[model samples]
Target: MQESHLSAAPQRTGNVIVAVALLVLMAVGGYFRFVGQNWDDFTSLHPDERFLMQVASGIGGPTTLSYTDPAGLTQEQADQRALCYERYPATSGIGGYFDAACSPWNPQNVGFGTFVYGTLPTFSTRAVAEVIAGLSSDQSWLTFYPIHLAARLVSGISELLIILVVFSIGLRLHGKWVGLLAAALYTLTVFSIQQAHFGTSDPMANLFAALSILFAVCVQRDGKLRDYFFFGLAFGCALASRINLLPLVGLIFVASAVRLLPVFARGVAGYEREAHWTQSAVGIILAGVATLVAFRLLNPYAFNGPGIFGLTPNSAWLDEVGKARYFISGEWDAPPNWQWIARPRYLFPLWNMVAYGMGVALGITAVLSTIVALWRLVRGKPGALVNAVPLAWIVAYFGYMGLQWVMTMRYYLPLYPALVVMAAWGLA
Candidate 1:
């Protein structure tokens, strides 16, 4: 088996070639698939993609966190508006109404201010690609393909990195075969791959999300500050990419506790590594500082003269976040027999949306695997410790989503890699 062979020895040369080929194929294919839609025209793009592309093209900017409807708005227009939280009530994270200084362009304290100007990383890539293509940066002089190509390149890279991270984690937890299978499943997902093809922050955010969890897994085994540093860097940047990922910060810690508690209680030399308060404290501080610095680098406008904890109401993102939360009322006023995964037929779209894309077979496999894994966990299976991170993260994210009424297929992406692993392993 590949697992035994890979465990017995590292075939560095073959592995690199195969991995590079796969990445190139995925990126190029994803780029072609999107551009094949006549991407040269702005109308063909997704609203968010159009926003980011226009920003990359010239002087257009992203919508503000406080965006309200303009007159004669279509559903598309309203949907395009940013999900600014109600400033009147103030979200749990902040006080008072929205700040005028941060209204249109710099609206987010928790995330980078760039939310107003689209994803800075995508913009930065467009700028660099223009230089490489020898095109003038002047809006009037530049051609569109380079910028469009750059967006695809950046997103595709992000998706590729996500697969690599998933592969690594799967390899670590269950050896080569399961890792490869999980990576393949993650890469094959239409939503995740589609995220890569688009010009949004999601791909980059997914990269960081997968990395944070992968590093969190590493921290479980070793409890190293360096691991925490990496985790912090990724976690901070992931939040910077999208504030919606805030739940993951807590989920990772929960996984750590579930993973480490047994060792501490039993004093098992082989299974346990002591988690020191000093180490954890310093690591957390380092993570926080790193997060601040990273968010600043990604979106510097968030940093006003004296922001609190690197966040000011002017640029903090909590308001928009709160608005997003409140927007979805979870209005499941349907018959009791209604399912949650069947579009209008389902009260909630969470499971329905997932099933629509994950395929019936794979989805069924995931459910069964989750059941077996949980059953084992209930029975105190020793080896189940490593599997706990994915399980806990899926549960945490799902539980959070269960409260949300706005159902997006992409929203479930961060949970994809972990679920894939459990499914594949459980089947075997």
Candidate 2:
């Protein structure tokens, strides 16, 4: 039977190859669609790249504490810091928002700053900045062009890492061919290419999401403590990068705790392992908290006390500045004439809309395939439901969609690799 499975591998490989080719073609198409709008402009505004430049300039570096005045920052500093915090908040280790002297574009409207743009009193931006700050020590290297270049190099490598991780997950769960297909599909997917190139937190966030899935599977396969540690680390990184992932981390904790419960019921062996589990859990929580504190100490809000999470109004400081930039003049808000209702209609034309609306169709296929695969695994189907990682992915997607109405294409990008793999399995 094993030999037969091996024999069938080549056919699977061909399907994956075709799928990957199609995905790559799509990415090339997307690149042409959006990249032409202003490749350099978009790249410059890339949030992560912007932060990297700030880090290079000592905006949020190791010595952030020394430069900041306990007496409260100057109006110039406050204004700049406010802008920085709106984009990149302060954290424990990383200094207060830097790179005030630089920043060609403000994300107030045309940028991805709306949902998360607040003063430095929050965790999400600061948490991410701390991790980035910790990544480098030499404050001088954080300049825009230099850091942008460095970010590209690092992000490119990270993209490859994502590919490898995806492949490994596919291989372990499905087969060599499935792994190849997923990797190939990922490589060709325009959405992956676009996000991977952008230095925003999304790519790293995607990496962390994938890591959670990877570790979850590993735990299912072997129930190893090391795997759980990896899971914790991945979850930590995810939260550190984007707090939108906190729910996913919560799922991991619950899932892992459940996995360990039966063993704990058996006693010593389970209890002995408890310390290791505790450490792993602590590591995740601390990575998040420590990042927050490190930023807070450096850029303590003038009017507020120490807290990693809270909200403070910027209107006071802005009012004092005599600067309307923070007000209607320079503010970035949804355009008054902007029609949110027609967004989906504008995105997909009539015929394409019908086809693209096929998320429902694709979703139905995924559900049926997942059920059949699961049944096969239980009743000894040759391929099994092991290839249905995308089902969990779909669950995450619907959870996001139902919880929030604002669904962007990027939000669904990570799931494509898994979905393609599942589709292949269903076809097989």
Candidate 3:
């Protein structure tokens, strides 16, 4: 008993140290994210953020019993009315949310015929802005400056959450020290800090992506039904924040497969330890159902909506998506396309990521860590396979995005959590 107590004393002390370290890291990271949130000075310098703010400001409940004809209104008046959040009331009820024609909630109804970005971040920001507007009796909260600032706050919070989730991933897979190291590294990442300062959806997308990876680690560790469900939920949220994170779905299959491998190895004997195939199958199905339900709920505008489950495809949204894809593919002749025209596929992105985004030392460490993780997996080292789950996502996502014509640094934000985790593990 004395030996046990003594051993536990050090464990408790270690846990306390870790907790304090994490708090300090979070505070520093929050400062980095929140400090320059007003850097644009109401100028709407970031075009993407400006567009998001416009959509957010425009979304609200129905203003009338029926669609207001825009024909009579001048174009400027129509745009102003579309952007007015105060025009809708709570008394308008849930039905207004699904009304695509004049429901202020719909981006398409906002006179912006094309909204290619994900809806979740915009909706979330608008909801928060409305609450502030109501509480302060300040309608200015619905306008561009205050509202975009609110969005930046949301982004900052999301980045902080990403740090927490990355820490959890490392702790679960490796240890407390690895988790702290990973969180510290991610907190210091320039790309993450920059994204967090913007009002765009990238930080939220990165948050959800990190959350999905954390839950994937949970699934790999325990294969619990809740783990699978939450993994799927996080994945759906990630996708709803940014369609670029669609590749994260592959992590689900990787995690599920890792969970089921032991069952295959032991055959009938594996069933003895609660590693039943039926439970895993059910978990996978539940994951899929949860993902679909979450995606639908968060991105209702993507469907023909009169309610949450409106499953019929929204043709306009689909068309916009296709058009955006075509433009981004560089097949269309556009000003932005010119920069990427002669740029080499993988090298350009790699150079930017190493040189400016992650900094040189950290980037090299991440690469070496990934290679070491792969080698350990090949050698069948203990814990190597679970580590491979994140590596699989890193490789697959990077491969797909690296090949794309759009090689923007923010596009690679989703990979940072896994890379930091791998780097931490390698260092430890």
The numbered model that scores best in TM-score is 3
The weakest ten consecutive residues by lDDT in model 2 span 102-111
Q: What C-alpha lDDT do the candidate models reach, one value each?
A: 0.61, 0.48, 0.82
Report the lDDT of model 2 for residue 188. 50
Q: Is candidate 1 or candidate 3 better by lDDT?
A: 3
**Candidate 2: lDDT over CA atoms?**
0.48
What TM value does model 3 have? 0.91
- Candidate 2 Cα RMSD after full superposition onto the native fold (Å): 10.4
**Residue 381 displacement (Å), model 3:** 3.5
Residue-by-residue lDDT tens digits, candidate 1, 1-31: 9798777566676577557755764565455
Tell me, what's the RMSD of every candidate?
Answer: 8.8, 10.4, 4.3
lDDT of 2 by residue, 206-274 (tens): 676777777766665555666766776666565545545555544444445544544555455755677
Which regions of candidate 1 are displaced past 4 Å?
1-42, 56-148, 266-277, 301-303, 306-311, 315-318, 329-350
TM-score of 1: 0.71
